[model samples]
Target: MELLQALQDRRSIRKYKDTPVGREAVEHLLEAARLAPSWKNQQCWRFLVVTDAAKREKILAGFGDDNPGKKGIAAAPVTIVVCADPAESGIENGIHYYVADTAMALEHLCLAATEMGLGTCWMGLFNEDLIRKGLGIPPTFRIVGITPLGYPDQDPKPRPRKQLNEIAYFEKWGEN
Candidate 1:
């Protein structure tokens, strides 16, 4: 599939089929993520794939009842937890790069999943501390996000996006 087309077609899949995702496909998606660029090649990102029912249950408990992604997490055949180590990245101009580095890797994984006829929903807004303890992630690492992976049960239309003119500039700010 074309890259931009996959980007356009990607959706936050909330419902999933009961069919399990193959390990090969998961590894392929992770390989795409592994290729993402990072500051000084730190590669601070670490992905935790939760397939065991027991582990999934523990991770699910970390997500609050109000988190909209909870349903998706519960339905997916697998959940990938995105974590990062700040010490592996650096700060520049008062902006920490670890977050950006990790986010890029996650997006790469999501896009790859989209291209593979799979589904993913960026699941943030969870209890970080609880998730860390439940997942047995080191305290030094931050839970950047989580994503459910599986064959989508629902095909959602694309959400609204800011036009290029509104969000991009050719030469100057507010100049197209």
Candidate 2:
């Protein structure tokens, strides 16, 4: 699909089919993230692909009681936990840069997933500590986001977006 088309069409899919997703497809999606630009090419992002049933349940527990993505986490064929090493990416002389760099990589992953006929949701409202422990992630790495991957069961209409004029500014902060 065209880049613009994918950008416009991709939505946060919460419902998924029971059909299984292949390893190659997952690899392809991760490859997109692997190639994403990072600060000084530090490549601080790390992905954990969770497929085990028991483990997936544990990860699901991290989500809040009312989170819409809760079922997506449990039912999707796979869930990828995105992480970042603070020592890498945007770090400069003791400052941290991983947050911005890792975020870019995650965006790349989501866009690639959309282009590949897969569904994804950027899950931020979750228990970080539970996730780290559930996935056996080291304490030094930060849990950036989680995304469930599968064939979408529902085709949701696009959610409302702010007008470009409301968000965009010219050379100056308030300039149109």
Top TM-score prediction, candidate number: 1
Candidate 1: tens digits of C-alpha lDDT, residues 31-105: 999999999999999999999988888888888888887988898999999999999999999999999999999
TM-score of each: 0.97, 0.94
lDDT of 2 at 19: 89
Error of 1 at 103 (Å): 0.5
Off by over 4 Å in 1: none
Query: Tens digits of per-residue lDDT for model 2 on 1-176?
Result: 99999999899999999789999999998898999888889899999998889989889889987999888877799999999988776657876778777778888888998998889998899999998997799999999889999999989899999988789999999778
* Candidate 2 Cα deviation (angstroms), residue 11: 0.4
The collision pairs in model 1 are: none
